[model samples]
Target: MTAAPRPKLSVILAAYNCADFVERSIRSALDQQGLSIEIVAVNDCSSDGTLAVLQAIAREEPRLRVIDSRKNLGPSGARNLAFDHAAGEWGAVLDADDALQPGALGPLVQIAEEREADIVAGSIRFFSHRRQEISGAVFREDAPITALGLKDFVEAARPQNREPDYGLLKPLFRIGFLRERALRYRTDIRHGEDFHFIVDALGAGARYILAREILSYIYTTRESGLSRTRVDYSRMIAETEKLARQAPYSEDPMVAKALTRRADALRMHELNVLYGDATGLPSKLKVLARSLTSSAGQRWLKTKIAKRVVH
Candidate 1:
């Protein structure tokens, strides 16, 4: 008998207590057109019916491979496990709560094949679960496909009024490149793992291409998600510090400067949190003084003062 041909793409999906949306996510991946893809889903010890749902689906779908984790391994660990089991040339990630639109994989694979890029990323369509509405695309739809380097990624990481981190825009990664470099997600970090992974890949000299026309990955916002429940300011700071110290930014003055500014913004946010909780005048004054020392702090102070004046 002839053996089955290898799939072109392997989608790593990590699910933890996402019973409500897991099935739809799997279906979306399976529904992707123009690509021979395999879905490698890891159930991260979900107490709900997530594991059962995946099992039932996998029994019928030969392309769907479900791995049940004996213990809860957060997002990073679960994805790492899926990656280990993946056998495709390219790797894509889809959160159990999110999905991939039809014809998503083909364009990405084409870009990677044509440019010989290590990573091919595109815009994401944001959908609000509560509102039942598709808000808009994250990156500009009209933007042309552009080659990106470490500097481009660092510049995108800079803190701004809008969500600055483009990590949520899931990209198709070359599996061979990642394996050769031994690149894997940091299992320690519960949040910001995607940001670190992308930065690390860029630092490792991975060729990146942004495909503006391929806006198929759907990022759905949930009120009960971990990001919405609590804000881990310290974790964000630690991730930023690691990114600042990465080899790609160390020798480059511009990238280093941008990282420093981003760090300052994170520090200012931490101080703001303290200021909001401080009850005594002396404590508030101390926070105010600290805020004045950093550029981001000064901006924050100006914004607050202007708001007060207007009110």
Candidate 2:
């Protein structure tokens, strides 16, 4: 008897109370063409029958395996567990409420193989029922595939208006590179953990590339999703402060300046979150004006206007 071959890609999906959408997410992953794929889905102690849904889907599909988490670990912890159980050369983290584009894995894997890149990210296609389509997150459709370095990533990471938020891009990683470095998402942070992970990986000298020629992921925007929740920018401030004091990020002048700007943005964002409901437009404008003083705010607003202009 011959053993089964390992899959080329392992998609680690961490689902938390997205019962209505998990099945579709799992199906999209299972339907990837031109490659053998495994869906490692972790049910993060969802009370909404998400576990049952995952189990039922798993029973019929040999490629899909569902891990029922005993406790409610956040997104980072759940994805960490899924990645540990994955049996693939390359791995990607997928959200339970979102999905992957058809035949997305082949090109990514090919690029990794040819370029020897440790991390590869592709632009996301925003999907909405009310709109034809949303804008790209990482790069425009016609943008050439570009090498993404630590400095580039940090600069683009600022809460900016015109630059692409690389944090929004879902990147595939070489399993060995991550495992060897003991790289995992930070469980302490409920927000901005993905950004933390990428920054750490890039700082560790991982060769990262942006493949924008082909859109790889489908981002399903839900009104009730966790993304709608206010970000814990205080957590971001504290965590980034720690990074700012440490090496690599602290050593480079450009990176240090960018981190300072980001920290200021986080501070401003934190204040806004605290004072969420203002009296009227005047108060809101006052708050907005205050935030715009920070470089991150200015950059974010600029790109936002640019997006409107292009579209």
Candidate 3:
């Protein structure tokens, strides 16, 4: 009798100067149960030992594949490179510094198979430096933001102010859905590209499935990390606005409300971080006053955009 085809899943990890953790990360992907995983890793021109580590892992594991770029393309660019090479029914965008827990992928893939879900999200267990589960909860586990019922579970997962530490973990995704929607990582988006990718996919009416199981994702909270530095305050604000504008809001009131609220919050945060002036105190206060008079929730957004022009 002929052997059956290997069960395949493409795990894409973008690494930049993550030599300390890339090996463990690769091992986590390899250790996953009941899946023939093609580990597609990209070394985004890391000055550190990231490439060597990936090469070493590739030698040990035949399934592991490494793509080396001569120049540093950011996370989105690296993932795009791997997307071209991925050959699997599902794709996962995993960070290099973080790792997946054993037994996470099998069940997640099962959800995708049964529900025919384009995107499958699972609960997260956020960890500290010591690799302990500090907290856990479903992403956007609240009303209003999560009130889109099944949709909130699919995209727009904001976990703050809900549970102890709510977050959206690694989402198992259908490769065909991404191709059909013409969705890929936005190259210009550095801070929240992953979030934007998922939302954009959902905006195109992509089917979603939520896996209720909690996955222990080891997240390192080191200061000198790529994640800490990528957030351009101005760009983050603009991307949120873009997301709000692009969403098919009329289709779902809950999604509409959540997008509006999220946009407002992004505006507020950006203004607080970047909306300052050296052009006299009075002029700044006048600008601030105009912002307040505009709208209660969206006033900050006006100020944020105006600051972008003046400063």
Off by over 4 Å in 2: 129-138, 222-230, 265-277, 281-311
Residues forming the 10-long window of minimal summed lDDT in candidate 2: 221-230
Across 1-311, the per-residue lDDT of candidate 3 in tens digits comes to 99646446899999998898788778888888887788899999999898999998889888888999998889999998988788888898788877788868877787678776777766665556555444554444442211123346323444233432122346777887888777889887777677677777767777766554445355555442534236564576566555555536545766666655555555555445443642688766665654563353256656466878999
lDDT of each: 0.81, 0.80, 0.68
What would the TM-score be for candidate 3 when compared with the true structure? Answer: 0.76
Residue 190 Cα positional deviation in candidate 3, in Å, after optimal superposition: 0.6
Residue 66, model 1: Cα distance from true site in angstroms: 0.9
Which candidate achieves the best lDDT against the true structure?
Answer: 1
Q: What TM-score do all the candidates reach, one by one?
A: 0.88, 0.85, 0.76
lDDT of 2 by residue, 1-311 (tens): 99989999999999888777788788888878898899998888888888888888888998988888889889999989998999999998888767888888789889877988999987787777356465555556778788988878876775643655667788999988998999999888888888899998988789998888878888876543533224677788778777877897888888887777667666755654544766788986776676676665676556556877999
Where does candidate 1 have its weakest 10-residue lDDT segment? 222-231
- Better-scoring candidate (TM-score), 1 or 3: 1
Model 1 TM-score, all chains together: 0.88
- Model 1 residue 42 distance off true place after TM-score fit, in angstroms: 0.9
lDDT of 1 by residue, 1-311 (tens): 99889999999999888777788889989998888999999999989898998999999999999999989888899999999999999999988778788787898899889998999987788777777787666666777889888767766754452643565568889999999999999888876677778878888889999887777688777553623124566778766766677665767887777676667767776877888989999999988887787677788888878988999
After superposition, the stretches of candidate 1 with alpha carbons farther than 4 Å from their true spots are 158-164, 224-230, 246-248, 265-295
